[model samples]
Target: MAKEFTDEDDALLAELGVEVETKKEAARTPREERIIAGFEEIQRFVTEHGRPPQHGEDRDIFERLYSVRLDRLRAQPDCLALLQPFDHQGILADAILVPGPDEDISDEELLSQLGVDDIAQNDITELRHVRSTADKRAAEEIANRERCEDFDSFKPLFNAVQKDIDSGVRITRPIRKEAGFLKTDIRSGEFFILGGQVAYVAEVSDFFKAPNGESDARLRVIYSNGTESNLLLRSLQRALYKDETSRRVSEPSAGPLFTGENEDNDLASGTIYVLRSKSDNPIVTAHRDLIHKIGVTGGDVAKRIANAKLDPTFLLADVEVIATYKLFNICRTKLEKIIHRVFDPARLDIQIEDRFGNPVIPREWFLVPLFVINEAVEKIKDSTIIGYMYDPATSRLMRTKDWA
Candidate 1:
């Protein structure tokens, strides 16, 4: 037989500081349902805006409204008996103790602000108690952060950069290898249909010339079949952007979600930009120098890009590799890590299961493993600053390191 505890038992247990009280089981009534509806509305308001009800008069009025529904519950023997096992005073004591929603955006006080009547729907006390305590904490954290102007000061720049990256054309790398046989001709250059030109292809080269007075950076594009096409620095840039956008859109959204970096570090995520220019065999690639100036420590790939002397198609592929791997690291390490240190530690355990039903940690954790790597990167200050020179005559991308 199930043991039944009296209201006095509930009071005694609560007085002893028990964490929870027992209540008799009974069928949920309409009054209970109404309470749930009202509570849900309150919850939604709080979640979206972040406002808590006032403690004194507002709370008292809310309880009064709640008791009207409880009156109905009291009429039912089962419901009343269920209540008998609850320490009502203790249960109701802190019922309205949830934190205020975002002080700025929370419209939680909207109803009161408009002088609306305190309407009673039902008693939602039980349902409200069922919500996880963690949810409240998380909500409070989100609200507080959202209210901090400094937290998202980069909204404009961030939005613009996101749009630029999102709007670019996607380019995918053609698989070159299959079971002992090369899938695509590595020697003859494939057509990059966008520029509508047949350029000679060449191996990825590293001997790019730096721009000088009256001279421009030259990006040599070589076709697979020993054919070649020369592109000015700007044209190469445009091609890189086109390829990045295309590849980004085509790739499925993997779970390593990207977020904006911190304010302290002016460096944000790296974006691939494509600038179009008409100069052929343009000398000096300034893109490398520009990133170098921006504190980019890993430019071996960029140097290799300069060396490849690739045609448009090959250059496009190389850009994808450089942007995805090298530049990606710049943002994740230099920017995101610094910002993540400010993340609330209490919310660190937050996670969601992937499609495979495996618990996956969020992108924030990726910084943890790269701490040493980032420290090493920051040490190479010379290679990471913006030290590029541009020449209008030849439309060149110039760098001192590549110059004599």
Candidate 2:
């Protein structure tokens, strides 16, 4: 039933210099309405808080959910264009300029945003049972993880594991199907080389049965670079199976010192001997405080230095034994190489006379303090010496960018 236009309506149109006609409002699709509603809610939150919501668990659950939704909307160009007209806060333009992890929103947050409410008044036992089943399914899908507050404590383990890998002290083996890693074989303190990084199983929760009757456990996996994830055991197994380079680390290669052992292995052990030359040469006297010859001996240090005066390798002079470190289960040649490589930058650059009077430069002697040598040995025993380099300028072991 349309109302008839009278002479008053004609007079009003004529005054405005326009013709009289019926106007209709444009209709919006349900999807467009939903997008507009979601954006409007975000705008309202921004208006109330004076800033956009941020990610993390410390914030309210709803704010985190809104942050995730805003991230997703900002990622979609089509959604940005569609809601451009209603964006009075310049949200579309600002979102188009910023980038973030829009796709990392959790499933629980998404379900909660979809109006999934908690059941508070379940009077029937059958309904309660149905709700329990749904909750179990949600739990299985979500992986029941929380933030690892103690991740800093496990960072050194990953660093040590990486150094061991680099030094060939720890080797990776292919994760075989019969290795029992997927089932009940995963344990705490074990390490796996996955995704090209060292992954340590820092902690593991008790076993629980999932909906399918399979065993599942929560794991606090610490990765290289000090970050960690509290993922399910099955999830970790799936990641390892999918990754081609994933392997299980064998025994650590740095020796028993890393295991906090005070005793040496059963092999024929050697000693790292630091010798101070007893030469009266002018150059040796000038640099006596900074000069020292470092070597490894399989036998007694006294016997090794008995003929130092006749040997050109000892600078053709008798030497005094300053420091000797007993090392077991290690190759003497390799230990010598390690010490020389660590102190290579501070190698003494002086020509000394041999017994035949031919000037020769000894490469094993370095112009470094005795304390620095002791510190280097300690780092080698801990398998972390590779991460540090000898700084001649500062006379200390500084961390290297390559390893850090």
Candidate 3:
């Protein structure tokens, strides 16, 4: 008669010297057992597929098979070993957890207290690992998007901006303060700001057609303020170049300098500065122009634009929207498509007239990130893994169950 083993018995047999029977049983009831069972299932699945899964492909498989009771299974050492790679190291400084001296517990005790048998610890650890990896990957991706071939050639501002993106905040173009002066100098680029920190983007050149009865030439702002005082291309270039003395800026110092605005030109009342980058590293310094008016219009629009330019809120929002729609599709693909159609008109209506005689909303075409806070939080609560796999373009997450 074939030997019969209980779940604990099988684990014990596997732990001890028992081989043939335990190995055979491991193949038969892999997915049914707790802890190592998920890993066995994964190994079997990989074997069935003819090879080991490559990097992120394993994560997809782990997310799918474990999603059933992931919160319960991930804490097991055996399960975590199979799911997480040995060589993987966290990039973010905060993710690297080192026990403090104030704590009475030792490292081993701290690890013990985390309840390796419980799923929460593994889930938290795994999430941190994934987040750190995503931060590194996001930096690489953003660089790729910007077509940066040399890391050294990339600007320091780019690194600063990415740091903000990882934290789920908006990036803002950096601004300089003058002693006892209310003057402001704005930096050029698309950015987001969250909670005082700014996610700054490198300035890219784009041309805008002349507005009605405006100049015939295509006006461009190397950087846009998202409101009035959007500088023209020539104007921005002039700001970067040396004026008056006709001598170039010495020792590679870049900063903003205010050029008084002409009220007669219908230009907004503010000072403009020639901001320059001094080092081999690209760092933009904003010289805030002194504004004659304060709180004239509702602060909402200005606040939103400023924040959006500096924080990861935009990226987070995109992630949430994508994940939400994706979950909707997984649950009811057909119905969701219909719903999207119903909502299409409302989205189309949210447009602003542009200088090119076309509709342009900063969120839609200005290449800025749009993050809706509540929606992101909801999506994260719904599916943690899918929430991370958000699509920037559509702001949606793909569902594993839906694919299955």
Q: Give the per-residue lDDT digits (tens) of candidate 3, residues 228-337.
A: 22234333223223122211111111111111223343433221111111212111112112100111111233343343322322211111111111121122333223
Candidate 3 total steric clashes: 48
lDDT of 1 by residue, 244-305 (tens): 22111112211122223444544444532221212121221333222111112333535534
Order the candidates by TM-score, highest first — what do you get? 2, 3, 1
Model 2, which residues run further than 4 Å from truth? 1-265, 402-404
lDDT of 3: 0.29
- Candidate 2, residue 188: Cα displacement in angstroms equals 22
Please report, in order, the local distance difference test score of every candidate based on alpha carbons: 0.32, 0.70, 0.29
Candidate 1's TM-score reads 0.17
After superposition, the stretches of candidate 3 with alpha carbons farther than 4 Å from their true spots are 1-35, 40-150, 158-188, 194-404
The candidate, 1 or 2, that scores higher on TM-score is 2
Residue-wise C-alpha lDDT for candidate 2, range 288-370, written one tens digit per residue = 87789999988988999999988878888989888888766777887688678878889988787776778888888888999
* Decreasing lDDT order of the candidates: 2, 1, 3
Superposed Cα deviation of residue 89, candidate 1 (Å):
22
